[model samples]
Target: MAGLDDYQFFSTLREKDNPFWQRTSDDRDRLEDPMDHYRRPTEFPEDLRNPAHGTPGPPPTKAPAPTPKFNELEGQKVNDVQMEKYGELSINIVSLCAENLLSHPFIVVRRQCQVNISSHRYHVLPITIVPALLHIQSCQGFSAFWKGLGSVLTIKGITLGLEDCLSKFTPWPKDISPHSSIKTIGQHLLLKSSALALITPFYSASLVETVQSEIASEKPGVFDVFKEGLTRLLSFTQPQTGRMLPVWLLVVPTVTHGVLQYILGNSVSTLTSKLLRRLHRNDQHRQGAVSKDSGSFLDASIRLQSAFIGHMAADVILYPLETILNRLHMQGTRTIIDSLDVGYEVKPILTRYEGFFDCLNTTIQDEGFFGLFKGFGALCIQYALYGAVLKFAQVIIQEVTLALVPPKPKPKIQDPVTPLAPSAPYTPSSIHPGISSLHTSPLPPPRTPYGASPATRRPLGYGSPGRRQDVDMRAELEKHKSSLALDD
Candidate 1:
């Protein structure tokens, strides 16, 4: 008859570091087995036997009156489950075939080629290959039958989400400088370097110094054009270092996938229309919803067609890079983190550009047509969800940062005095806000000479008469020259 309090109190006195005491305190049920008092249910309860319980019983054994069967039954009976299973099987077979045909050596070569082409186009190496490989290894225990499928979706989702979020707040050209003199060319270059810097450390800082040093080398204006063009291209694809796929390979596939889908989608829609027509034609005695003042089957069919098209289109655009990006991350490159110390030689050989195509075509030839779409089925799901979330998050982060930090204002200049014709009617546009006309009448300029003629003038020193007017005119000319210089 030991009390629970007695055990706990005694355990604390044993010492804080005592393993036995700690275990006893941490798991009271384990130390004192409660299953010793276990019980099992044997019979039904009184409430269950009572007819008052809300349990449903068998239906009355009676026949219903006959009614005309709608042809909708035929439409509904088209065996959608079977169709779905067939589609899944087709996807599996196609992906397997593609993988088998595309040999490991070819894949490696294609991956290396992707690195080269992407690096050439972007002027920076995407070192995500290492991370991508690592990811594959870690997840390698999973069946190769569905290889790259999950990874592709994950990569797409993250990259798209990040790009979307970053785009909204820090929309291109994403200028980072606070200095007014460095606003246009300087800031643009900074952004480009910054994006690259994220992947390859210190690239932006080095680029800045390079530009400044090169300022003395060329017509400074030519460099400005270079900065602008490079900035725009880089902005088009703001690559994130941690994405599942390397950013370089993301472009061609996404665009191609989107286009192909649009073309195929239209065909599928036509097929659906023919199927719906057949169903409507088969049923005469059965009154359709349209005939009874309800919604038409045609409308439902079209909606379904539209949904199907949209789903397939989205999948096409986002699926290819899904596993590739993940593969990139798992096989991440150290080059990104150590970009500053490393000097990259930017060059693209013909071999680099053709390698990916060779691998792709070879895989198809060996593995059958399905090899081209390896990992696509799983990727479809992955891209749909991942792309959506990643895009949204990145956009939000950029927007929030920009909104919190607004730009500063610049300095202004003072306008000088000017002469105006009294006979000419001066319009509002002709007059400067800060500067007023100096009168040219016969009057001694200001001071003790009150009520003098307006045309009178002043002297430089006490003896030099009308000399101040000459000085004033020269000053005005210099100011005019300065203003003109700024405009040019």
Candidate 2:
């Protein structure tokens, strides 16, 4: 009897080791009858029933199931980001072109107004915006309004591209804190001002082109105008000796005006940011909510408004310097420019400025302090229309983009399905009495590696480790996509 009991106990232990009888802890607890284990022994082959009687081989090694090379969601996200960048770029380019095209007439009138020699001898009086526009229209025809537009666009494109390239290549100091607004602004100013200084010749040439009236009967092409402007800019001859003036004379005023303008704009922007922050904080306090930082919708609107205001303020404040710079640009190029008066008459600059300070002093002495802001009204109106048009266009573009490519729907969250039990003749509940409770009771919430609550835990292949893997995978996918696009 004792020997039989020992055999049964060993057989039960052996049964537990068999793969066929393998079950979760819950399944083992579901056994109602102790004899059930003994009854199940006859179901397996003789070799599996008693491992000691036969040698058990190692399980076959199978290759891990291939993980997907790319995730659709991740790819979509990458595409969306790229699309946004491209869309913004297109919008900016379009906006710039549109603004320049629509507002260029005002610019032409303003330039003419600025360079007009207010003298009794020349009969060139200080011209207002409307009269100047009308005079230019009548004398030079309406087409004269866009005279130097090509040069302006060319200069703008070069400046923007050069600045972008310079900023990318510029070596930032390691010690400078990213949070230090002043240092960052200074660094940006240095780079941009340097860029401006480098392109002073082009800028001066363009300004000169804008103010000069065409003498030839045929309208010149953009390239021809640009070439002629460059020639004129370099051909500045000293009145006394007829020797060409040095390039540095043009560089000084242009660089100074650019640097001062940038500084004033940045100062205004910083002040506006601080004021917005204060107002936001006060509003948050009133609403009894935690104040959000500067990335919200309200903050974006504030930033846009501040930038617009800053640019306007800077332009208004620096109008005198701009006027002086224009005069300096035209100093040696003693060309007959449109007076923007009633008659079909043109006049040459009467006063020759030695330098920026000389130009400023002479203008004040001869034309009064207000002479510096000759075309101020036209400038204000141009910018106002530009801002309104740009804002409207952006909205239209955004709406069109949405209509063309609707945003993807958010993925739905489904409840986790309990892992299915292996197929067998007996149900899991019949395997053991204690396991019966497992089928009837709700599953315990799964614990995350990060100790997150089940409700907050993301599904497999998302968040933390999975998200990192997805990012790496997405990078590889992006490379492949770009290569494919290039090939196409």
Candidate 3:
């Protein structure tokens, strides 16, 4: 009986391992008795379950998905990941510092304006405002940093990746491969799509969220408050027809800015950058001649020169585009906050300016050519100084990075051939062992001139001596010198 029980236990164990039984078991585990679509644990209808016999509750809303994890240190091990994360953290912290330093001035000015400081001032003097615009708040700095981060990741980074892929996949002339025009168009598409997908949603939310209302209302003048409020009117997924102007601003103004930047800003910037770099190079060359340090503006002076010039020109000269863009965003909106008094009447601002071109034409016709540059003074204060600070901040960050992470000491480049001095002493390696061993004839020692003794041998400059009968080399040299002296 015990043997039989053992056999039964063994059989059960073997059955668990068997493919057929395993499949059966899996099927059994999966299988469940059929139930009603709206199944309840009590086996009752909603009407029955409810003591009041009320309607059923709607299905629970799905919670937002958990953020996905990525291999932050994807290169290798846990230690590697930690190192990479730390490096990235350091860079981000440095960038944050830069952003804060650069943008805080503008934020402070706006804050001052909010507080009704110098209330009557309509047109701020660029000189006076530039200094004020230099200050950045911690929050404002972080906002700018995050905004820029979003811009890069969603728009620029994606565009770069797409462009790289396209450049690789698409065949073209070797010289003009990954054509600039084509890439620019793609960039526009990517930028717009990115703006719509990423920026627009956040922007739309920020509009109705009442987050900036405090500052928006704090600015002096009822008209200015209204204008700011109108600018921040609600714009969700289904923005009203009149409210669609911000969309137009997002599309045309950005594209126009890009076009202008490419044509005017880039050319001037490049030209300026090149000139500055050339000058810097010249200065460095002079400095190197004088001192051994050879320190230019920055360690990577070329990059710094380009960044500063390009960024400065864009911020200062191209700021008018941003003003126009804002104006465009303001146009075509039907909703008006107007005066709080019921009796007060407000003029309809823009009936004809229903879209981008219309708004642009209207601005030009009504306000003159300089109308597009309405905020030019403010922009000069904001962008110009901000740009200077930002670029300088970048330089500072790079300098710090160089100091701490100190770029992999650039490989010591070996010269193609170090010219041997004419007076250099001949070594054993200088002698051609094969050539020397080939000849059994007892000639001058290896590397020594043939027919020349080591004591009287001329160094490298005077050509190799031909094999000859044993002779006094010094005597010959002395004789030649005498002959040359006599000739002179």
Number of the top TM-score candidate: 2
Please, what are the lDDT tens digits per residue for candidate 2 over residues 1-488? 22344344434543444323356465668746576657633345433644875767566477699987988688776666555555576566666575679889778777777888663222223234466567667766777878878888898897888887887788532223337778776777677777887677677667766777776324446676457545644544432323224457767778888888877886797788779778878888898986444323344445555766677788888888888878777666565676655435778766566777877888888878778877777787777887887677667766665565547868999999998685534222122332211111111223335877765764322333111221233443354455455556
lDDT (Cα, tens digit) per residue for candidate 1, span 390-422: 334334533543454343333467696685534
Once fitted onto the true fold, the runs of candidate 1 whose alpha carbons sit more than 4 angstroms away are 1-250, 284-298, 309-356, 362-370, 376-488
For all candidates in order, the CA lDDT equals: 0.35, 0.63, 0.42
| Candidate 3 Cα outliers beyond 4 Å, as residue runs | 1-101, 104-124, 127-212, 215-243, 246-250, 262-266, 287-301, 331-352, 365-368, 387-488
Please say which candidate is ahead in lDDT: 2 or 3: 2
| Each prediction's RMSD to truth | 46.2, 20.5, 33.6
Prediction 2 TM-score vs. true:
0.56
Error of 1 at 116 (Å): 20
The TM-scores, one per candidate, come to: 0.23, 0.56, 0.39
RMSD of 2: 20.5
**Total clashes in model 1, counting residue pairs 3 or more apart in sequence or in different chains:** 50
| lDDT per residue (tens digit) for residues 1-488 in model 3 | 21334334333433443321133465467545465334532344444554565665666577699898765444233443344445445544544554455544343233223222112332344554433223322213324212222222233444455445545655421122224687666554454443343333233222222112222233223233333333444442335564445443355455566556645655665677668756767887887753444333333344444545565577557654654544444344432211111212222224434555765676567656655544245544655665565566556654654465423334579779986545333222222332221111112222444787765674332344333233444554465455455556
